[model samples]
Target: MDARYAIEIDGLTKRYGSMTALDRVSFRVERGELFGLIGPDGAGKTTLFRLLTTLMNPDEGTAAVDGLDCVASYRQIRSRVGYMPGRFSLYADLSVEENLAFFAALFGVRVADNYDLIAPIYRQIEPFRTRRAGKLSGGMKQKLALCCALIHRPSVLFLDEPTTGVDAVSRSEFWDMLAELKAKEISILVSTPYMDEADRCDRIALINEGHLLAVDSPRGIVSAYGERIYTLSGGDMYALLLAARRLPHVRRCCPFGAAHHLSVDADFDAAACRRQLADEGFADVALQPAESGIEDVFIKLMNHE
Candidate 1:
């Protein structure tokens, strides 16, 4: 299939008083592509979503969703776009079936009209069709929300932090559902704080403090990390973390998986650091060549900024 652009954002900017939410942000998602906005909390991911979904106007710049302007064509965009906000906003008292029917009615459609689009996810929660939404599990709630959003057969889907606060098993299953949705030609834009999830996207934009750090395929981003990384674990974890930062050869050091990882100066001697740590009373010191991942690269980029 030809890769057509589904959503286009250019120089998008938004501010709340003196704080800028989105700073000249720009990116594009191809039709039927699973794109991800990877970053931590307060990185302007939600603000950007609101702009594309037409919930809020931008201070400057322009955004187009399915060839329709976000500001002037909001009604058209709303009809064609399915948005699942970061927080759960479904009616707590309504049954699963009722919630779906209510959303379908709002779009001038019937729950049965778009059954094919939502069946895969909705069926998993159908056993509890009459159960109140507030009483469902996290994974079930997410699945129901997704079903309601997609009941209109929207051309574009925007999911804001859909996996946050959910269990690991639920997160895995949620991504699997996204993969299945991609097969059906739905253009999906998902925002997440989990760096590990970035690898699942066709393209990822790393955002930090309202600035765009990098935008590329997962491999492309990792290939750009040219520094050597080392994991250190021994006595006085706190002291080791602090000492690594002060070392002349260590470019950057941050906590990772029960140990502090150091991105050292390319010219630094690994043996010398081992000897230094040994002298400082660190026992069973270990150092090895390690591969850099998205989170490592994100930390390095944040430190640079």
Candidate 2:
């Protein structure tokens, strides 16, 4: 039990019958740090969250939350750690205020007891506090869930895919809320499938198929990318994608928005590529050097795995 760390896991392992969800996962989150688990769907982010929140026990390895062992101290961990599951688990028929009150009561605390703690977030939806959770829009529902999760003022918070189906603006606002929460010194462990959200955290762990591929500051991982990416765009995106795979000296090609992001070896010549595309009956072909981003890093790591 290390008090300095908010959450600590050593060789954590979990499996579902034949499938291994997490393998030898080890990491330590410093107090008040915002840590993100970035990966795609089915990448075992949810499984790791469950193990840490004491909802389920890991088959192997040891986990501690705020100096409490996840297994031996399951009861205490549940009381001290707030968990907002990936899915909306609140009572759909309950009004916004009701849901918050119910969750508070579950912990034997009253909503007014932590009103100051949740005021920043709860105020956003306070006007609609009487509306049933199921009838609220996606963004409003998200806010309600967050308020319920925070009512207890736990030392650590676990948010699983908090922005999953929300609109762009809502997503932005949700991240802003997380930033505010982090300021309050609540250690947060959040998981999301969006690679772009990696930048919001102080540090991140990139996971895929039960393997913890990399962990570092968002910039640190991008710096390790080691390869320069060329953004290519032309009239025909599909044709460009197909043609990109055939380019000489090119190691990786993935579609990024309207452009095809490509990584190539030293022998690859940009001028030659443009001429080659022109020869292949493609016109207005262009290629520009672009800095590698988190998406590129994840793709590179997955390929190596």
Q: Best candidate, TM-score-wise?
A: 2
> TM-score for each prediction?
0.94, 0.96
**Cα RMSD for candidates in order:** 2.1, 1.3
lDDT for position 256 in model 1? 89
lDDT of 1 by residue, 92-169 (tens): 999999999999999999988889989989889999999999999888899999999999999999999999987777
Error of 2 at 39 (Å): 1.0
Q: What's the true lDDT of residue 192 in model 1?
A: 95
lDDT of 2 at 113: 91
Candidate 2 lDDT by residue in tens digits, 1-305: 79889999999999999999999999999999999999989899999999999989999999999999999999999999998898889999999989998999999999999888889888999999899999998788888888999999999999999988777788888999999999999999999888889999999999999999899999999897648789999899999999988989889898999899999888989999888989998899889988989998898899992
For residue 258, give model 2's deviation from the true position in Å: 1.8
